[model samples]
Structure formats: structure tokens, C-alpha cells
Target: MPKTIDDLSTPCLLIEKERLEANCRQMQARARAEGVALRPHTKTHKMLSLAALQKSHGARGITVAKVGEAEVFAAAGFDDICIAYTVVGAEKSARIAALAPGISFCIDSLEGARQASAVFAGLGRTVRVLLEIDAGYGRCGRTWDDPSLVTFARHVADLPGLALGGILTHEGNAYQPHQAATVMAEARDRMLSVAVRLGDAGLATRGRFVISVGSTPSANVFRNAHRDGFSITEIRPGNYVFNDLTQVNLGVCSFKQCALTVLTTVVSQHRGAGGAVRFFLDAGRKVLTSDRAPLSDTYGQLLYHARTMAPHPHARLTNLSEEHGWGAVRGGSTLTVGDRVRIVPNHACVVVNTQDEAYLVDGDEVLNTWRVDARGHVQ
Candidate 1:
């Protein structure tokens, strides 16, 4: 027998459907106003239903971080997808070639381009390849000023079975800023400048040169700064779908709009010295992610019941082990065991990895459940 929303087990992930729909619409509207295609990254939710909702809200396509993720989405009917990772190795290259007829993959090194070209040679099909540029994030991308970048692009263009699809970058460093506005402006400028440089090198004139940029903190800035000649045709942000404690601490979103939360039952309550009340919950790093950025310390944020769904100002998560979370309630108020509480994780992506399925809830009512099909696809 399948379990409905309400009859499920505790210490589970719950997603508010209405809030998720609102977030999808908000990003879609912003993409429309900016005249850029929204290709939201599916690594956040990893659920086909949410991806469909994004498409219905005017998204051109979706983005995935790994080949397995792309396969999962493609099997779910997302054909026009982009795998935003550097292609390498024969196994991955074969998978990329197999997916070439339906989706696109990114390339950053000459060796990867050559491998991709060799793998797709016999099908008479040209794989759409995007030259990844190193923005502020020092991740896997060729440096913008690397003299060999144009040579590599030309090499990829000259290849018999490959088509240079333009440049892509993830400005992930923007999340470290003290203010959202400043980070957004800098990330937008960096991406736009790279796109212009790629165009100046005659990359866009060949065909549909997709200049993709993304990261939730930077998407808002890109939307405001869109213009012609920059060639920024797509944006691929993932975390916007389920805002988390890190985003809230960094001022990216508020607590109310957060869609994902882990519902845990209070297992124990004891008294500490100096008349302090200690509360322990069954949820810990195993349920809530411990992947906190520089902004937050605890594994997740504790939500206390009030008049509505507001987080209690004095409620805070003080410590966390593998399977236990400890916290202190202000004023030493007593809390009985078996009480239910909701915890907002520090990082939504990591939380998605922790659960195999999540409940779709609306207000206080449970709606349905969806499998996290693309979990653990780290490659």
C-alpha cells in the first residue's frame, strides 16, 4: 500500500507545493523580463515533476551536473538538456555520445574535446559542445585569459563530429559576498564580459552560441543586466527552487519562502545547570545536511511553532552529531518528548542527497510523494 502525505514516517523531508510553484513562477518572470532563457539546474530537486513545473513556467530547458543526472532527466522526457560538466574518459564520452542526439554537454579541455569528437564520429552527428570559461570561481574551466582558449575553440570547431556551442560558467563565488546586490553585480559583469569576448572571437557567428551563466545569488543580477551582444541566452540556477538556511543567512531568501524542511520528533528533553532546558531531536546530519558555507555554523535551522509558520527568533540549533541534534530553548521552557518540529537544512542540495523520497505538502495537508531518482549521481 502506498502512503499518502500524512501517513508517512517522521524525520522525513517535506516540500510545500504551493511555495515551490511560486518560486518557479518568480524565476520564470524574472527570466522573461531579462530576455534570457531559463534553464534551471535539476540537481536541486532531482524530481521529474518539479522539472515539468519549471518547463510549464517558461523555462527553455534544464541543466544537470553529471551525465547520470542528464540521463535521469532525459529518461523523464527532458530532451533539450545541458550537462554542465567537463566531459572526460571513454565511459563518460560514450554516454555523452549516446545522449548527443537529444541533449548537449560541455567541454573545457582539448583532450576532452578530442575524446568527444572521436566518440561521435561514426553517427554523422555533431555534438553541441560549450567551452567552459573560468569566471571568479576557480573550478573546472579554462582561464578566460588563457592564450590557448581560442586555439582550443578552433580545434573543437574544426573537429569532424563536434560543434562549438559557445561558453558557459558558474559564478559560485558570488555566494561568499557580504551583500547580495554587490555579489550579483560582479557576477553579472564577469559573465557578460566573457560572453562578449567569446563573441568577439567569432564564436557566436557560427550558430546558436549559448552563453549560459547561473547561481542563485547571481541570477537576479543577470536578469537586471541582460542586453544584446552579450550573447547570454540561458541561465542555470538550481538552489533557487528550494531555498535553505545558508541562503537565508546570506540574505538570498527569507525563512517563510523555504520549501524544504525535515520534520523530526523530539526524542528527549532534560534540564541543564543554571536552569537551562536542553532539547534533543531525532534529526541530525543524516537527515539534514552538514554542508554549511562560511555563513552558518549548525547543520540546520530549528523552526519553533508560533502563531503561523514563522521561525522562533530565540530558537537555535546548538550542536549536531551523526544521528542526534541538540538545541537550547530560550527562557528554559520545558518541551515534552514526541513533540513534532520542522528543521530547515543548511544546504538544500545536500538534503536532497540524504533522502530517497520527499513528501509534497500543501499548508498542513500532505499531497503526494516523489522519488529522489538522481540522488548520489556525483559523477
Candidate 2:
């Protein structure tokens, strides 16, 4: 059966099979060259098929952001999994602990470590834990030079049902294209310094890939670090699987490297009294998402035709209603109502979660549809 994007419904996800495979292979090659383990963050697509594709490309393990995602991947036989987010509280801890000793996750404080100790002890399974260090992201973890870091490490080492693995960081501020190298190199040095301090304090870190960092923008930082004699053992780049506008704006990946897109249609069109052209697309904030790339005001980049695969330079997605994407072009569009278009969304990670399944395409020819196995696994 020959399938095409036209046969599929509007406001749905589409992943280019060839581009995705190339993205995975390129990241895998970088990891191999750096001699670091590639544990790609599966939070981007959250599908069994996508994670399996990454694992096939030499991903030693997988990195997920939630306990539910961890459970989903673990049940699918992903033996080595790490919940990149800190799993705290009795409910969260028990759910995550059940996946151990095959699972590992992050922790930032002695309090979370203390909580994990009680929960995992009751579950009777030892879990590996990495202490998170803040590298300018400020969303989680302590600063690298914080005195509580060693205290937290000592507790993780001594706590029952927990083994101190090593240190981790998410240098999210390193997303700047021009400054990523400096920012991430400095972050790597700080993380390594903390690792040295933990060792000097006599804490036995058992995990093999201990000094880890995540962020697609900082992917090459890991490579450079490893090449320059820094001991970073793992990288967890998630959005590299389906690079989005943000990856392109941040200069991490080129525009052509982006694989995921939304197939939409021009449901309605209007011409203002002053002769301005307007278009209302079937996809809205719900599908394309409101996540805009840096300096790019639009929600998603528009393509005139899926078969053409050429980005429309002038047409701008101005606003998004719940079910309508309002766009405008300075000059009149040759497009009319019912014209199909594909959009390269600003954030592939959040956008994929909006769909139950995504059509796999190889240059407009739909090959298959894969379930988003871990979608909505935000627990």
C-alpha cells in the first residue's frame, strides 16, 4: 500500500524516517569519537520505536524525565534506564524504585536522598543515584561550589537502598550558539571539580558513567571535553532526535536536520479591506504548540507543500487560537483554502507529546505510524 501525507489527517505529527536516522547516527558517531556513552534523553518523542532506534545506534542506555516514562521504557525491555529528573516523594519513589537495580536517577539534596532511602528500603531494591549540580540552569540542583554537595554525596553513599553514582548537570544556559563552547567547557570543569571533591571526601562513586551532562545545544561540549582529556563519560541530548526551530536558532543543528513536523491545512483564508492576506490553518496552539524559538516570533515554520518541502520565507504564523493557526504574508499567497502544509515546530519535545501517534515518512511517502508509547507519562 502506498501511503502519503495527504491520506493522513490534519494537525498530526510527522517524523521523517531518513532525517531521524541520520540525526541518531550523527550523535552516535560523536559519542563514539569522544569515547562517551550516548544515553539519549527519550523525553523528546517518548515512543518505544524511537527509543529502540536510538538504542540500535549504540545508545548504551536511555534517559527519561519522569518515573512513568522510566516504567514505560523499562517494561519494554530497556534494561539500562535513568530518570534524568529527580524522583522524590513516596509515590514517585516507589514507582521508580520498582524499576531498579536496572534504573538510576538524579537527586539534588540530602532531603530527597533521605526520602529515597526510606522509600527504596521498603521496596527492597537498591537504586543508583547521581547528585545533580547546577550549571546556570537554576531549575534544579545545587551550585557546583555549594558546601551541601559533599553532604548530599556522603548521605547517598551511606543511605540504604541507594548507591552514589556520580555528579550530573544540565547546562541549559549553554544553548547560545556562539557561547556554548565556553559555557559548557566551564560547566564541565566545575562538574569535574565537584567530582574530585566528592572523591577527596572518600565517597565511593560506583556508576561507570558518572560525570554526565545533558542538553542538545551542549552536545559537542561533551565531545570536546572528552577529546581534551576531561573525563565526561556520558551525554543525554534529547531534542537531537527531532531537531526543531530552537535547535536551528541555537545553531546546534541545521534546518535540514529537523525531522519532525506537523501536517496542517489552510482551513480558511481572508483578504483584508487594505489588501493584506490572511490564512487560518487547521493546526493551532494545541498541535503546533506556542513554543517559539529564540528571536523567532512564530510558533512554527511553514512549508508551502509537503512534496515541495520548501519553507515559505514570507508567510508568518502570527497567532494561534485553540483550533486555528492565523498566519499572514505581506503579499498575496498563491495558496487558497484547503491547501495542505507542513510545519517545523519550535519544540519537537513538547510537540510530539501532543499527538498519540506520528506518521513515519520518507520524503512524503508514509511508511508507518508509531504509537507515542510514553506520551503523557509525566508522573
Candidate 3:
């Protein structure tokens, strides 16, 4: 029973309660003011308590990247959930059947849609399915500019057990300032073109089919475009709730807005080559998950001088092994072994997934310890 933040073991996840509530409130307000629904992607935190916080802040629905995550959220009383990944396999499809009727999900290929239709139709269930558009990520889904997108959407709508719910995209590659503008613009133009064509075909319309886009780096663009009366009906930014170092480097959110962090202790320290102060933190790839800022080698930043909330002036984790992180700071020799610190991971999504549970803290006090109910649902 870790009674306080200081009592917690090293290399554990922590969430600042006040900052998290603020993040959720602001994002929900942004979506509301833009006349679009805020459907937060829950893969970021994977905590049921945080998801409830998002829902209380007026999130219309929640988004998950896998069928298993959807099941976790669904079993927890989340009625409106969207599985935002192209699900595969019989076990996954059968799992979808249990979430039928109100469940919404994404698909990029006809064969996948056909398999879903076969299972759903056999079970006398029709699931809401969204066509996923690859907005320059190259991960999955048809490219936003794919010429066959409209025809493909029509074929999906024609499936007996699939309801054409909407179109969605994740601007995952829009991390840098240079890529943000171009990728966001491309998403708007290409998605609008596809939606308009689908409307023309009478299979789906803007009045009927939703147009959604997500990515914390492009959140402002999502709001502005929707406010300017674009076809966008929903925004699914996930990492906004716990803006990580990645969001900070991209200028999406400041460090203060970051609600999630890894608490660790300096187990060892020494003077390294060139007489720089080097330290080994108890956290490493297993705890922080080794995701760097986009296009950069920085593993993460440490809150130094025994200040869990004050970022060190220059210290950064440059390398990591399984259970140790190598860090060095210039002109800093006061750091000692056993000094507690907090680390801001480059990406928060992977960090939370690595933890079995997280301690919710307000200042030095542990408000509550919550299980990561939706963690590790990668099916």
C-alpha cells in the first residue's frame, strides 16, 4: 500500500490529477466550440479512471486502436466506443460480435470488411464501420488521395452487415512543424474529396457519414477546420490528455500540461568522460519504453535536483538498456545516488501500456492508485 507519492517504488507511472483534468476539459471544450464531437483515443493512458474523467468532461465517445481495448472499455460501461483499427482474425471478429449493434470500428480493405460482414450477418448483427484513410502515415488504410477510395467506400456500404458510419484518419506522421501544416491540409482536401464523392454516389453523405481526424499535434487544425465549416464531425486526439515530451517538442502542449510521468530514483552517479556528471536512473527501456521525440535521439528529460516537477537545466537521457538509463549533465556534480526524480517520456502512450497500474498524484500525495484496465490489449 503506497500511501503517498514518495512511498511508491521507483520506475512506476504517475498521473497528476489536476493537470489531467485540465487537459481533458480543454480538449472537450475545443471540440465542443468547434461543433464536433470529442472522441478521445484511450490507447494513450489505457486507464479506465482517466477514460471516465474524459467522459465526464463531455467526450461524446471513446476511441481504441484494437478490438481488445474496445472490449475492456465496453465491459467497463462505455456504451459508445469506436475500435479505430482495422481488426483481423476470427477471434477478433467474434469478439466484435459481442460488442455489436452500437460498436463502431475502422477498416481499409474490402476483404477485411467482407470477413466482418460474414460474421456479423451470421449473428444477425450490423456494426457501424468507418473507412480509414491513411493521411501520410503509411501504416494502414488506403491513402487519402487514393483514386479508388470512393468506389471502395461504396463497396463497404453495400456489405450486408456493415453500416457505413464515417471516414477517419490518424495524422501520426504530422509530428514536426514542417509536416503538421502540409499533412493537415492534405487530410482536409483529400477527405473532403472522398466524402463528397461518396455523397455523390448516394451511398453516404456529409449529413450522414462522419468525417473525423485525429493527432494531438494537429489538434488546433482539427478545431479550426471544423469551425470553418469543414466536413469534419469528430476529432480523436488521444495523447492530448497526457501531453508527453513528444507533444512538448512539437509545440502542441507545454510541459506543465503534461499529466503523466515516470517516477524513478538515481541509483548511481559518477564523473564520466570529459569530467561531466553522469548518472544511472533506475528507469530504462522497460519503464520509459524508449520512444524518442520525432526525428530526434533524445530519449527523455529528467526533473533534476530532487525536484520531481522541475525539469533539469540540461540533463537528458541519451541512452537506455533494459533496466538502466544513461544520463549526463554539464557542470552538475551535486546529483547523488538515491535522489528521487520524475521523467517525462518522449511518448506517453507506450509508457502507460508498460505499467500494470499508475498512481494518481496531486503534489506529493497519492490521490488514488488505478489499474491500467485497458493496457496490453493489442489484439
Best by lDDT: 2
Candidate 3 lDDT over residue span 1-379, tens digit each: 7778778888898888999999988888888877788999999988889899888899998999888888898888888888888876556788988873568888888888998889888888888889988867788888877778878888988998889988888887778656676777777667777677777777665456788888887775663453223377888999998998888877777888988888888899987887778999999899888677865566886776434587787787889999998887766856788887888899999998889999988878888999999777887
Off by over 4 Å in 2: 204-209, 224-230
Tally clashes: model 1.
0
lDDT of 3 at 34: 74
Question: Against the true structure, what is each candidate's TM-score?
Answer: 0.93, 0.95, 0.95
Per residue, candidate 1 scores C-alpha lDDT tens digits across 231-332 of: 467789898888888788877778977888888878998887777888888887787756775566666777774114677666667887888888787776
lDDT of 2 at 32: 92
lDDT of 3 at 78: 89
* Per-residue lDDT of model 2, residues 1-379, tens digit only: 4388878888788898999999999999989988778999999989999898898889989999999998998898998998888777877888876674678888987778889889987777788888888977787987898877777677788999888887788888877657777777888788777877776687744345388887888886564443223378888889999999888888787778989988898898988668888989999988887887887888888876777767888888989988999988866787788898888998999889989999999987899999999998887
Q: Report model 2's TM-score to 2 decimal places.
A: 0.95
lDDT assessment of candidate 3? 0.82
Best by TM-score: 2
In candidate 3, residue 13 scores what lDDT?
86
Candidate 1 stretches with Cα past 4 Å from truth are 1-6, 224-228, 273-275
Best of the two (1, 3) by lDDT: 3
Candidate 2: residue 347 lDDT (0-100): 90
Task: Provide the overall lDDT of each model, using Cα atoms, as 2-decimal numbers.
Answer: 0.78, 0.84, 0.82
